[model samples]
Target chain A: MTNLTLALDAMGGDHGPHITVPATLQALRLSSFLHIILVGNEAEITPYLSQIETSVRSRIEILHTTEVVSMSDRPVHALRNRKQSSMRLAIELVRDGKADACLSAGNTGALMAMSKVLLKTLPGIDRPALVSCLPAVNKTPVYLLDLGANVSCCSETLFQFAVMGSVLCEAVDKNPSPKVALLNVGIEEIKGNDQVQQAGQLLQQSPQLNYVGFIEGNDLFSGNVDVIVCDGFVGNITLKTSEGIARLLVHQLEKGLQQGFFVRLMAKLIAPRINSVLNQMNPDHYNGASLIGLRGIVVKSHGSADESAYLQAINLAVTEAQRRLPQMIEERLESILLDINS
Target chain B: MTNLTLALDAMGGDHGPHITVPATLQALRLSSFLHIILVGNEAEITPYLSQIETSVRSRIEILHTTEVVSMSDRPVHALRNRKQSSMRLAIELVRDGKADACLSAGNTGALMAMSKVLLKTLPGIDRPALVSCLPAVNKTPVYLLDLGANVSCCSETLFQFAVMGSVLCEAVDKNPSPKVALLNVGIEEIKGNDQVQQAGQLLQQSPQLNYVGFIEGNDLFSGNVDVIVCDGFVGNITLKTSEGIARLLVHQLEKGLQQGFFVRLMAKLIAPRINSVLNQMNPDHYNGASLIGLRGIVVKSHGSADESAYLQAINLAVTEAQRRLPQMIEERLESILLDINS
Candidate 1:
C-alpha cells in the first residue's frame, strides 16, 4: 500500500478546529502510512499541533487558510465567494492531486458543490452521490446513497448512483457481488413515483450489477441488500429520521430507568452492556459519508461530530484512499455503461 | 354523544376473524353506545359470534360478504372487481349511512381507492390523505398526513392537506391553534424540491394554518409541531423508516440483554418497567390511520395488528365518528379556501 495523504478541513463543523485538530492527531497515531494536511487558520491549528513530537509532526503539515465556510453559508454563495475557505481548500488539495482524499466535518451542501465544481464527476457519471454505511442486522453494514447530495434525481442519475454504490460496496466491503436495491415506499411492482419506477426498470435490466429490486423503508435495517439507492430528498430524510427515532427511543428508555429504585439498580447493573451494544448501533458512530462518483475522494463528516466520530471519518477517508475507490468505480462503470449502451 | 356505529372488515388483516372478533367484543364491552357491523362471510364470522352472549352479540351484526380482499390485491383491481369483498362491503356500509365510520386492517391502497370512489372527497377537497398519530416528546402525539394516499402531490394538494390536517388535529386532539409544519430535507427556506418549496411558500402564506416552516426527518418526533405535511411518497417512507429503526433498536436491546448471566438477570428484573415505557412509545400501539378528506371516516389499521392493536383501530373509528371529522374539515376548508382565494 502506498502512503496516503488526507486534507483535513480544520475549521469545519460546529466545534471547528477544537474537534478536527484532536481527531487529526489521533488519526495520525493510528495510521503509520497516513499523512494529514491541516487546512485552517495557522494560529488556531498551531496550538493543537505543538504538543506532538517532531517525528510524528513531520507527517502532519498545516496548510493555513484565512476563510472558513460557516455552516449556514449557502452552497452557491459559498462556491462563488469563499474559494479560500478551509472546506474548499481541502477539496482543492484533492483536485490538485496533493492529497489522496479530503476529510471535512463541515457544511454538506457547500462541500458537495465545491467538490463537484473542483474535482468534477468521473466519466459517465452525471452527479456525485453522498454514500454512507448504515448499521444493519447482518455482520456487514448496508450502504445507502445520495444522502442530501442531489435533492432531486432523474432516472439516469439514480441509475448512476446504483452502479457507483455497487462498485463502492463490493470494493470496500470485499463482497464479490453486492446486492443492490432501490428505496421506495413499497417493494411491489408498480409502486413509487415516476423517477423511482424508471430507475427500477433501468436497474432490473443491468447485467453488470446485482440488482435485487425495491426495498421499503422498514426493510432498510434488515440488511437484505448491500446497497440501497434513492434520490437525495428521500435518502436524507431516511437517514435523519432514523437518527431521530433512535434518539427518542434511547431517551424514553433512560426516563423509564429513572422511575423505580429496583429498576434503577437493574439499569445500573446492565448499563455497561446496553451502552456497548447501543454505541455500536448508534448513527453518531457511523462517521464519514463519501462523496462518490467524483474524480477524487471527498469524505464529509457530520457537522456535529465529536472528536471520536471525526477520527472515524478520517479513518474512513484513509480506508477509501487505500482501496483506490474512485479508480475502481471508474473501471466498473465503463463496463456497466457499455452493457447498458449495448 | 349519540350512538356511534362502525363497520369492521372481519376477514381482513393477517389474523382475520381471530383478532377482529375479540377486539370487537372488547370494544362493545367498553363503549355502551357503540354498535359494530362485522362484514365478512357468515361462516367465518359466526363461529366467533357464537361464543359471545346474546347481550353483547346484539350490538354486533354480521353482514355476510363471500368475497375477501387479499392483502396483495391491487388497489384498482380490488376497487373494480371486488365490490362484494368484505373490505369493500365494510366501506360501503359507511357510504350507505348504515354505519357512522368504517375500520379496516386490509390493503391500504384498496381501502383508499374504494373509500374515495364510494364515499368521495369533501366538496372542496381535490384528494384524500392518510393521517396517523405518531409518538413524540410532547403529551399529545404528532399528526402526519398523506401517508401513501397520493404518491405524488401537487402544491395545491399539499396546501389542502395542511388545512385538512389542522382541522383533524384540532377536532380529534382538541388542541387549539395547532402548529403545522411541512416535512422537507432541511428547515432552510431554500432546502427542498419544487413541490415542497412551493408547498412551503403556500403554507407560509396561509393565515388559517399556524405554519411553523420546514422540518427535517429527524424532527418528526420532536413534538414541536402538531401536524406535519408531505407528499404521500415522503410521508410513507418517513413513517415506515421510523418503524424500521424502532424495531431494529428494540431487537438489538433484547439481543443485548440475552448475553451474560448478570445482564440477563438485570433484564428480567427491569423487563416490566422497560416494556411499559417502550409500549407507550411503540408505533404498533398507535393504531388506526384515518383516511381524511373523504365524505366518511375510514381508519386503516396495520394488517399485522393483534387483538389490542385492532381494538385501538376500532376505538379510533368511534372517536372520529363522534367528532365528525369530515364535517369539521368541510367547514374548515370552506373558510380556509375563502381566505386563500381572497
Candidate 2:
C-alpha cells in the first residue's frame, strides 16, 4: 500500500501535544507507509517531537501555528478569529491536497465548522454527518451516522445520511452491500415523526441501497444491520446513553467483587478474562468518529482520548485514507441521485 | 394505610395468567391492605387462583372477561371492538371507582388508548405520558416520562411532561420538589431542536418546578436529576437502548467466563455475587411504567415480564394507589397552571 499522509491537530484534545505526539509516533511504527504533519504551536509540540527516534523523525514534520482553539470556544468565534489555529491549519492541509486526511480531538463543533468551510461538502450532499462504528453482538461493528452534526434534520437530509453511512461501511468496513436502517421508536411503518417516516419510505424506494426499514435504539448493538441512520439529536443521545450504561455495568461488577473474601478471590482468578471483555466494550476501543460527506476526510477523536485511544483515531484516518472513502462516497451519491432523478 | 384495590389485566403480557397470577399472590403476601381483582378468562385465571392459600383468598376476586387484546391488535381496533377485553375491563374499574389503580402488561398502544378514553387526561394536560423509573448509579431511581405515548411533542407538551413527572417523583418516590430536566443532545442552551430549546426556556421561567435545564442521555443514570422529560420517541428509544446495553454486558461477561476450565471454575465460585449485581441492573427490577397525566392511575408492565418483574409493577401500582398519585398530580398541576396564569 502507498504511504498515506495525515495532518495531525497536535494542539487538540485535553492534553494536546502530550497525547497527540506519542500517539502519532506509535501509529507511524505500526504502519510503515504512514506519515503525519503535526500542526500546532512550535513550543508545545517540539518538546514531544524531539523524543522520537531519528529514523522515524524523517516521516514526521511540524507545521507551526500561533493560535489555539480551547474546548469552550464557540464554533462561530473559532471560525472568525482562529483561522491560524492548529485545528484549522490541519484541516487546511487536507483541503490543499497536502494530506490524505486530517484528525483532531478538538472542539467538535469548531472542527466540523472549520472542516466544512474549508473543504466544503461533496456534490449531492446536504450536510456532513459525524459517523462512528459501534461494536455489536455479532462481533462486526455497525456504522451509525449523524452523531451530533445536524440537530434538526429533514427527510431528504436523513435519506442522504443513510446513503453516506452505507458508502462508509462499504468503503472502510468492506461490506459489499451494507444493510441500512433508520433509527426510530418502533419497527412499524406508522412509527416516528414525519422526517424519519419519510426517510424510511425514500430508502425503501431506492434500488441501490439495501434499506432494512426502521430499528429502535435497542437494535443498535444487536448487529442486525450494517448502517443505522438517525438525526443528530437521537444519534447523540443513543451513543452517550450506551456509553453510560456500559460504565454502570463495569462499576456495578467491581462493586460486586468487593463484597466478600470468596468473591474477591474468585474475581481475581477470572480477572484476565473479564478485563479482556471490558476492554472490548470500552468506548476508547472505538474513539474516532468520521466527519463524513465532506470533500476531504476529517476524523474526530474524543476530546478526553489518551495516547492509545488517539492511536485508534489515527488508525481510522489511515484506513479511510487508504480506501479513498470520500471519492467512493461521491461516486455512490452521484449514482443514487441519478437513480432518484430518473 | 387503607386497603387499596388494584384491577389487574391477568390476560396481559406474553405468559398471561401464568405470570400475573403468582405475582398478584406474592404481592398480596407482602401487603396486607392490598386487594386485586383479576380481569381475564375465568378458566385460565381460576386454575392459578385455586393454588392460593384459603386465608388470603378473600383479598383476591375474579372479574372474568371473554375478550382479549393481542399484542398485535391496533389501538383503534381494540378500543372499537374489545371494550369487554381484560385490558379494557381492568381500566374501566379504575374509571368506575371500583379500583384505586389499574395495571396492565398488555399492548402498550392499546392500554394507553383505552386508559385515555376511559379515565381521560387531567384538566391542564394536553396528553397522557408513559412514565417509568430508571435505576441510577447513586442507587436512587430517576423518573422519566413519555416513554412511548406522544411520539411528536410540542414545547408545551414537553413542559407539561416535566410538570407531571415532577409530581410523580414527589407523590410516589417521596422526592419533595424533584429536580426536573429536559433530555436533549447536549446540556448547552444552544444545543438541541427548537422544541427542546423552547421547553427549556419555559421550564426556566416556571417557579413551581425545580427545573435544572437540559441533560444529555448519559445523565439519565447518573442520578444527578430526579425527573428527566422528553418526547415519547426519544424516551422510548433511550429506555430500550439502556436495557439492550445491560443485556449485552451480561451476555459478554458470561461468554468470557466460559472461555477456559479455570475461568469457568472461578466464574462458578463468583456466580452468586455476579447474579446479585445483574439482578439489580435487570430491567425486571424496574418493570413498572405508570401512564401519567390522566385523571385515573394506570400502570403498564413489560409485555414479557415474568412473575418477579410483574410483582415490581404491582408494587408500583400499590405505592401510587396508597399515595393518591392522581389526586396529587391534579393538585400540583392546578397550582402550576394558576402560577402560569397569574
Candidate 3:
C-alpha cells in the first residue's frame, strides 16, 4: 500500500509547532507508511524541521503559511480573516487532494467551520457531527457523537448522527452491526424531549442500523452499546463531566497516598501497578476526536495534548484516511436514501 | 425550639423496613428534638419497631398502610392507583401539617409526581425542579437543580431554576448571596443552544441573583460557583456521568492493587487511607436529593441505599424540617417577585 499523507496544523494549540512537530516525527517512526505535512510559518517550521533526523527528513514536509488562528478567535471571525492561516491551509490540502486527511489541535469551532466550508459535507449529510471513541467497561471503545458540533439538534440531524456513528464503528472498529442507542434521562420511550423521542422512533424504524433504544449517561461506560447518540449540548456535558471526574479521582488517590509515612512507603512499593492503572484512565491516551460526516477526514486533538497524545491524533487520522471514510459514508448514505425513496 | 416531625416511607426502598427502621433509630439517637412517623405495612414494621431501644421508641411512631409503591412502577401509574400507598401517605403527612417534612426511598418519578400534586409549587414558581447537593473540591457542597424534572426547559424556565437553586444554597447551605452559573458547553456567552444563551442573559439581568455567567460540566466539581443551574436532561446526565466515572476509577484501582503479591501486601498496609478517600467520594454519603421549589420539603433517597445511607437521608430531612426551608424559599420568591413588580 502507498503511504498516506496527513496535513498537520503545526501552528495550532498552546505549544503550536513545538508539540506538533515532535508528535509528527514520533508517529512517522512508529508507522512506516505515513507522511506528514507540517503547516505553519516558515521561520517556526524551519527550526523544528532541522531537528528531525536527516535520514527520515524525506518523509516530513513543511507547508509554510503567514497567517495563524488565535485560540480566542470566533468561528465567523476565523472563517472571514484566517483564509491563509495554517489551520485553513492544512484543511485546504485535503480539499485540494494534496493530503489524505487533516489533523489539528487548534480552535475546535474554527476547524469545524473551515472543514465544512472547504471540503463540504457528504452528499446526504446535512451537518457534520463531532464523534469520538471512549474507553468503556467491556474493554472496548464506544463511539459517542455530536459532542459539541450542533448543540441543539433536530430529529433528522440526530438520526444522521446515529447513521454516521454506526458507520464509523463498522469501518474503524470492524463491528459489522453496531448497536446504536440514544442518550436520554431514562430508558423508556416516553422519556426525554420531543426531539429525542422522535429521533428514537426514527432509529428504531431504520432497517440498516441496529437501534438499541434509549440509554442514560451511566450507560456510556456500561459497554452495552456501540454507538451512543445525542444532541451536542448533552453530549458535550457528559464527555466533560467524565473527564472531570477522572481527574478528580486521580487527584484524590495521589492525595490519599501522601498522607503519612506508612501510606507513602506503601505507595512507593506499588507505584508501578498504580501507574499502569492511571495510564489506562488517562485522557491523553484518547486525545483525538473525529469531525465525522465531512467530505474528507479531519481529527481534532486536545489543545494541551503532549507528544504521545498528539501522535495518537495523527495515527487516528492515518487510520481514517486508509479506510476511505468519506467515500464509505457517502455510499452508505446514498443506499439509505434510495431505500427510503423506493 | 419545638421538636420537628418527619414522615418516613419505611416500605419505599429495596430493603423496606430492614434498612429504613434501623436508619430511623440511628437518626433518633442523633437528634433529640427529632420525631419520625414510619409509614409501611404493620406486619413488616412491628418486628423492626421491637428491635429499637425502648428509650428511643417514643420518638419513632409507625403509620401502618398495606399499599406500597414499587421501584419499577411508573409515575403516572403510581399516582393513579397507589393513592393509599406508604409513599403517598408519607407525603400526605407533610401536606396535612402533621409532619414538617417527608423522606422517601421509593421511585423518583412517582415521588416527584405525588409531591407535585400533593404539596404543589410555591407561588411565582412555574415548575418545581429536582435539586440536590454534590460534593465539590472546596470541601463544600454545590447545589445543582433540575436533575430530571422538566426535560425540555425554555429560557424563562432555566432562569426560574437559577432562582430556585440560588435560594436552595442560601436556605440550606446558608450562603447569603450564592454565585449562580448556567451550565453550558463553553464559558463564552455565544456558546451552547439558543435557550442556554438566552437564559444566561436573563440570569445576568436578574438583580436578585448573583449570576456568574456560563460554566461547563468540568466546573461542576471545581467548587468555583455556589449553584449550578441547567435543564433536567443535562443535569441528570452530568450527575450520572460523574457517578459512573467515580465507580470506574475505584474499580480500576482495586483491580490494579490486587494484581501482584507485593502490591496486594502494600495495599493492605495502606487500606485505611484508601478507605478514607473512597468514603469521601462515596455517593452514599450524599444520598438524599431534595425536591426543591415545592410548598413543602420532600427528600428522595436512593432506592438501593443501605442503613448508613438511609440514615443520612433521614438526617437531611430533619435538618431541612428544623430550618423551615419551604417558608424561607417562599419568602425569597415573594421578595424577588416584589422587586420585579415594583
Candidate 4:
C-alpha cells in the first residue's frame, strides 16, 4: 500500500537470488511502508517464491528481464548489447519513476555506464561520484567522495566533486555544516601538487563549502573532518589499502592468538574489546555508498557482495530516497556551476 | 682507532641537537668501526662532549659550523646563504675523504641541493635518487626509490632508478635478484599513461633487474617484491602517508586502551603484541633512506626526527660506509643509463 518501491538486481552478486530473496524479505519486514521490485528472470525468481510467507509475498513484485551480465564482461559492450540485463531493467524502474532507487551488486562499470546512459547526470553535475562511509573516531561514519568513480581527474572536476560531496554530507550525514577537506600529501597547504593547491583555494574561496583545509590519509579515521574529497584514483587506492591492512591485522591477531594456550586465554579476556574495535571499523554497519549527482538513484555494490551487503545496499537506497538527496545536490550545486559558466 | 668516519649533521631536525647528539653516541656504541664527525657550532658541540666518555671522545670529532638551515628557508637559498650548515659540512667531509659518507637530520631539499652541487652525480648518472627501505611481509625491508629525490620524473629516469634501486637493495637489504616493480595505478602493463607503459616494457626487457612487475601502493607491504621503483612525487607521498597513518593508528590505540577499565585490561593483555607490531612498523627502525648515485654518500632523516631516529641514521651511514655502497652504485649503474640514451 506504500509508495516507497526499491528495484533490486536479483541476478547480480555471488549469492544471487539464493540470498537475495530472503534479504529482500528481511528488508521489507523492517518497513510496512516499503515495496520491493525484483529485477531478474521470472523463471529463476519463481522457484524461490514458496519460501517467503504470504504476507511478505504481497509486498514483493517481480519485473522480468532475460539477460545476465557477468562481472568480468566488458561494461560498454554489455550495456550496448544486453537491453534486457537485470541491472538495466532495475535502473529503468528508477528512470521511469516506478521505483525510488535501484540497488545492484552487478558489474560496477556496467551499472555506472547504464546509470549515466539511462538516468543521466543531475543538472549542473560535471561527473557523478561514488560516495562511501568510512569509520571515524567516535564510531560515526564520514562520507568520502569519488571512491573509484573516476581515475584521471582535473582541478575543475575535483572542485565540483567537493561541492557535490559537501551536499551529500549535509543531505545524508545531517551535519548542517559539514566539514570538508581535500586529501593531501601533508598538512601544510603548499605541500600538495598544483591541482590540489588550486582546488584548495577554490574550495576555501567558495561560500558553498566549509573548506576544512587539507587532510592526509591518517585524518580519514580521526573524525576531524566530516567529508574528504579526492579524485577516484587516489580514493580507490586509499580505500583498498586501509581495508587490506585492517583485514591483515585481524588475520594476524587470530593466528597469533591461536599459537599458545596463554595467548588464547589473553584473547578470550580481550575478545569483547576487540569485538568493539572491529565492530566500530565494520563496513557493513555503514552500508551503501550513494552515487552522488546522478539524476535518479543507483547504488553500486562490491561485485562479490553477499546477502548482508545487499541488504545494506537496499537500506542505503531507501534512506536516500526518503531523504531526497540528489535533488538537494542539484539545488545546492546550481549557483557554483553557474558562477563558473558565467 | 677505526678509519671509518660518518659526518652527522647536528643542527638539522625540528628537535636538532637533542635528537642528533644522542643518536650519534648510540651509533658509535653499536658499531666498532666508526669515527663520529659531529658538524655544528663549536659552542653546541662542546656541551654535548661532556656526555661522552674520554675513550669515546678520541673517536668523535667536530667540524665547527655556525649556521643551521631552518625548515622555512628555501633549498637553494639555504645552500647559498647557510655556508656552515651541518648538511653542507657533512657532504664536504665525504668529498674531502675525511669521512666515508654524510648523514643528516636536516632539510631534505637543502641536502639534495648541496649534495648535487658539491658531491655531484656519478658518471652516467642522470639523476641521483633517494632510496629507502619499507616494510615487506617477512618483516624485512624493501627498497623504494626516488623517495623525494626528484619531484618531476621521466620514463628514462624511472627506468634508470629501477637499476639503481636493485643494486641498493642487494647492498643494503642483502636480497640478491631483488624483484623491482614500477609503481602504477594498476597491474596491467598498459594500465598507466604512456610514460608508465613505456617504462614497464623497458623494465621487463631489462636483464639487470629482476623486474617482477607493476606494483600499487598496497603491494609495498605484501613482500611480493623487494624493490619498488616510482617517480619521486608518488614515492614521497606514499612514504609520508604511511608514516602519518601509523602514527594516527597508535594514537587511536592509546585512546582506546587507556580510557577505561575494560580498555586498560585489553591494553594490558595486548600490550606486548602491540609493541611488537609497532616496533615492526616504526619509521626509526627502518630509518635512513640513501641518496643513491651521488659521487659520495649522503643520507637524510625525516624532518621531525629525534635522537633515536638520528642514531638510526648514523647506524645506516656506518653500514653504507663499510659496504662502500656509493662505489657499488656508481659501478653498477653506468651501463643502464647508456641503454636509456641509446
Q: Tell me the deviation in Å of residue B133 in model 1.
A: 1.3
lDDT of 2: 0.89
- Please give the interface root mean square deviation for model 2, in Å: 1.4
Candidate 1 lDDT at A230 equals 93
Task: Answer with 1 or 4, whichever has the higher TM-score.
Answer: 1
What tens digits encode model 3's per-residue C-alpha lDDT throughout A96-211? 99999999999999999999999999987899999987644457788889999889899999999999999999999999999999999988877888999999988777888889
Clashing pairs in 3: none
Model 1 Cα lDDT, one tens digit per residue, A213-323: 999988898878999999999899889988887777777788888987888888998899878766766666678899999999999988899999898888889889989
lDDT per residue, candidate 4, B1-342, as tens digits?
Answer: 456888888888877777787777777777666788888887876776686776677788888878788877677798789877777888899889888998887777778888999898877678889988764324667788877778657887888788888888888867878888987766755355456678888887767678978877666678788888876756765666555455555456556557778768766876787667655655555567788888888988876766776677777777787788878887777665555557
Choose the strongest candidate by TM-score. Answer: 1
Please state the error at residue A285 of candidate 4 in Å: 6.0
DockQ of 2: 0.75
**Alpha carbon deviation, residue B324, candidate 4 (Å):** 3.1
Query: What are the Cα lDDT values of the candidates?
Result: 0.89, 0.89, 0.86, 0.76
Candidate 3's residue-wise lDDT over B212-240, tens digit each? 99988767888889899899999888887
Which sections of candidate 2 miss by over 4 Å? A135-138
TM-score of 3: 0.96
lDDT score of residue B174 within candidate 3 = 84
What DockQ do the predictions score, one after another?
A: 0.78, 0.75, 0.72, 0.36
Where is model 3 chain A poorest over a 10-residue stretch in terms of lDDT?
Answer: A132-141
Considering DockQ, which of the candidate structures 1 and 3 is the better prediction for this target?
A: 1
Give candidate 1 misplaced runs (Cα > 4 Å): A136-138, B136-138
Worst 10 residues of 1 chain B by lDDT: B132-141
| Least well predicted 10-residue stretch by lDDT in candidate 2 chain B | B132-141
